[model samples]
Target: MSEPMLDDDALLRYSRQILLKQIDIEGQLRLSRSRVLIVGLGGLGSPVALYLAAAGVGELHLADFDTVDLSNLQRQVMHDSASIGVSKVDSAITRLAALNPQVQLVAHHQALDSDSLAAAVAAVDLVLDCSDNFSTREAVNAACVAARKPLVSGAAIRLEGQLSVFDPRNPDSPCYHCLYGHGSEAELTCSEAGVVGPLVGLVGSLQALEALKLLAGFGEPLVGRLLLIDALGSRFRELRVKRDPACGVCGHAQ
Candidate 1:
């Protein structure tokens, strides 16, 4: 596909980013034509959506089955007090539209099952697993693996957060299942564990950064590495993650 031409207004709007040596006109144009699917419109999803839209991602598929609650305002910056009780995707669309009218926003109000999830993943250039649970994470991973798309995953609980990128097209990348097996461990929710507002922002911002790097083909993305952030301590750590050959999700046997 021929690259889309950026007009004067676009160049000015993205001037700061375009000025970067790593992302000149070519990279900015790539970002302007990329499509991304972000599942879940909660805390992490909020910032991911905002940044991607602000950065001029051509299209965004926003999926969220839940409605906004008053409590969500604490961290889900995409919605406000007036948006309480409204579907999150709708609320997010309002904010994202206002943020960048040039970007197309597609809302998926219903939760995605296996078949639907795979279809969604197949239709997008990349997938963002911003959902809150292990089941959703596993399902998103499986769909991305099947479709061979890059997946940017983020999570935040209490004062800690984690981020990782898994690209099925890369044999060395470790998928969500490879790291956290299909064991039925208890899942933790922000409501239950009590998460700090900025913690989610920290992780979600990184998720957006990594996604942009992957799409723009600039800088080293966190494909085989896991980033852990201790917000309370204000420290960050990176751990190398290896693909599990015997894993059920993305293994050759499977």
Candidate 2:
């Protein structure tokens, strides 16, 4: 089928990106036709949602069961003082609509059960795992694997951050579980470990970039590569991530 056509206003709004060699008019149109699901609305999700909306991703499904807390204002740029005490999805909608009304925003404020999560992953072209906990990340990974969708995952804690892309579409691309392996609940959360606000912001911004690359069909997504950021020391490093043939979550060849 032909892609959705861009109107005059859309052409003007995305003129800068359309001028790029990598993301010419074609790429911008692909972005305008893409659909994505983000699994969090906290520090990591804030930038991911903001940039993707501004860049003109066709539709975004935001899933966050938690309400906005005052503490989230420090990093969750999508939510402001007025948003405090409201659902995070509601807050993001108010903010994103103002940024780009043309972009569709779907809310999933309820905590997703196994069935709901699977359905959510199945509906999207790609999934971003911005959730803070291990269990949610694991569930998202499993859902993506089962549906054969690409998963962009990011994590930040204290002064450290990590990012990677695991595409079930690419047989060589490792799933999230392949790298971390049965993570223990002993993982320290940002609240408990005390995360620096900007660390997550930086990671989330990169995650947004990766998503844009995949959606707009420009540049290389971080497939099978792990990025490590040491914020305190200001260092960036990339490590190759190999798929584990014995991985429990995604063990079979497509």
Candidate 3:
């Protein structure tokens, strides 16, 4: 007989997910053995962290230096007014653990930089880039490429949200760099562009779905394609994306 699962509480908590044909007890077991790293705890990161924890991911590493602010409550579902001034990672851990105690929360209450990104990505099976800055996003992509880990990236501004997966393990898959090019300071931020609160919820939830698909290997992920949702116009579009032959990060590997 197969080795029995070690945690009954985990099994009970994940019963709904385990009931799915695509995620039976075996998949639940796998989820309890995987580690995910999220590089933000804001709009996109909030849902990503919440859903992944609820899904019973064994380990979750949250990296964010910023503290909760009144503005964050608009899109960040994991925090409240009482959490304002507390580090995002810390607040996220408290909320996520309350959601699913089986998940081990690792809080990195520091900003992500070259050194930290290298170390953080090296320890996780997957990385989710939800930071709203180009420099951080590019740094995350580079770190994932270096570690050959699957990355689930998402963004929302105004009424638009976009999501894509960059699995370096796939020879034909496109890295984030392949689609957005390198970092540019001109990229818009919520401070300047203004994002709808629900818009973030929509996009952040999709990021969770993509992350779950990668973890369970149950569905086709958005590895070589991008999903664009324009809530203002109520339009959804899928665009084909390819690995750039000259992409400094993924090109040589491909």
Candidate 4:
């Protein structure tokens, strides 16, 4: 198939990125044709959605089951006071459309079951696990694994945040299940545990960067490495993660 050409407007809008030696015109065009799925519209999802749209991702599938609350404005920058009581997906689409109308936005306003999730994963080039809890993360990971898509996962709680990428197409890549097993209910929520606002932004932005790298085929992505951030102490840490052969989700034994 012939590659799509970027028009004059697209070239101008993305000229700054195109100027980079690593990106140039080819990388910008790649980004403009890539599709991404982001699960969640809360704190982490806010920046992930914004950055990917601003970067000119061709299509974005946004899935979120919650309604925006006034409290969300603290860190969920995608929504505002007017967005309160509105479905997160709707609110996000409004903001994302304004950010880049050239990018297509699809909103899934309900929680996705296994079948729906798998369908969404199959259609997208990449999946971003911005969900707040483990169950959703595990489900999203499973869908990505089943579809053999790249997964960019990010989480923020209290003063700490972590980000990782898992590509089922890579045999050596460790999935989310490999790091944190299934059926473990730790329930460390931001509301109950009290998260700092900027922590989510920090993690979500990294998730966007990873997704962009994966789609653009640029720098090395964080496939087997987990990045940890300590907001209170202002420190960052990295840990090597390996695929668990016995992992129920992506292990060969499964």
Candidate 5:
């Protein structure tokens, strides 16, 4: 498919990005031609959907089987009190549409089984695993590896957060399972362990930035590194990750 031409309003709306040589008209056009899939529509997906929609991504595929709850309003900034009972994808659609009417929004408001998840990953240029569970992250990672697509995965719990990018296209990059095998004993959700709202916001915002860098074909992605956040001390740390040749999920992949 041909890349869509940027209209006059689009040029003006994204003028600041176009002003930067790293993401000039060509990069903006690439973003406009890209399609992305976000696995969850909670805290991480909230910022991801907002920024990508505002930045004029041509298509966004939002998938979530949950609905907004009153408790989610604290960090799920994309949804409001009025949308407490609405489907997260539907609520996000309303917010994203208002943010950027130019970007097309596709909703998958159902629990995606193995076959559906594989199909979803194969249909997108990239995948963002914003789901707040270990099983979902592992599932998303496996799908991305099978499809040879990039996956930006993030997690936040208590006062800490984690972010990483796993791209099967890069042999040096580690898949999610390579770094976190089977699952960690430390996998805790916000509901069980508790979390500060802003910590999630910060992590989600970074996830959005990483997606933009990947889509625009500029800046180095965190493909072989893990970013750890300590919100209690406001400290950030990076850990180098190597691909595991013996990885069961991605060893035979790519």
Candidate 6:
């Protein structure tokens, strides 16, 4: 098939991204035609949203129910002090739109539940889970598994961060549940545990990069592996992840 024609503005805007041999004009076209759903507008969600929008993803669906607070300014780069009290989704979309008007923005001004979650996951080619809470992470993972959409998941707290891709498209790959074991009932949140600011930026940017690679059909993703970052010591580690045979989610299929 002939590649979609890029307008002059698109060429100039995405010149750097397009220059990579892995993401040439053809790959840029794929990016321009793709859609991704991001859950959350907090720490991790902030960088994921910004980089993805700047990379020229065709459409981005931003989901978050919380309103911006003064405390959020530390890491939620998508919002400013003036945005306090405004819906996070609105704040994020406004910032992202300002970054790149070439992409379409879908703002979901509501929290994600099973029903809404499935619908949102189903609508996008890929999903990025940047929410800090484990319950929401599990719900997003389940929805992605049910929809068979690829997911780039990231988390950060107290200078620790991890990122991985759960692609049902890869039969042998594990879903988030297989690696994390459905999360404990005693899951922790950044609000309670206290997270470092840049930790979210580091992990979330990687999530955005993985999503773009997945959508553009280029680069080796973090599929079947979890990357751990300990910024306090400036260390990095990776663990190979595989589907659990007797486990739920992708296990049976694998």
Per-residue lDDT, model 6, residue 194, is 86
TM-score of 5: 0.98
Cα lDDT computed for each candidate against the true fold: 0.92, 0.92, 0.89, 0.92, 0.92, 0.89
**lDDT of candidate 1 at residue 120, scale 0 to 100:** 89
C-alpha RMSD values across all candidates: 1.3, 1.1, 1.7, 1.3, 1.2, 1.3
Question: What's the residue-level lDDT of 62 in candidate 4?
Answer: 98
Candidate 3 lDDT over residue span 1-254, tens digit each: 76648467776778888889998988777777899999889999999999999998889999999999998898899999999999888889889878987789988988877998899999999999989988888889988988899999999998898999999998899998888785466888998989999989898899999988888879789989999999999899999998999998778874
Per-prediction backbone clash count: 0, 0, 0, 0, 0, 0
Write candidate 2's Cα lDDT for 1-254 as tens digits.
86578899999999998999999888998898889999999999999999999999999999999999998888888899999899999999999999999999999999888999999999999999999999999999999999998899999999999999999988789999899998656798888888888899999999999998888878889998999999989999999999999999998857
Stretches of model 6 off by over 4 angstroms after superposition: 1-3
Give the alpha carbon lDDT tens digit for every residue of 149-188 in model 5.
9999999999999999999999788899999997675677
Ranked by TM-score, the better of candidates 2 and 4 is 2
Lowest lDDT 10-residue stretch of candidate 3: 2-11
Q: How close is every model to the real structure, measured as TM-score?
A: 0.97, 0.98, 0.96, 0.97, 0.98, 0.97
User: What TM-score does structure 6 among the candidates reach?
Assistant: 0.97
Instruction: Please identify model 4 stretches exceeding 4 Å from their true place.
Output: none
Winner on lDDT (4 vs 6): 4
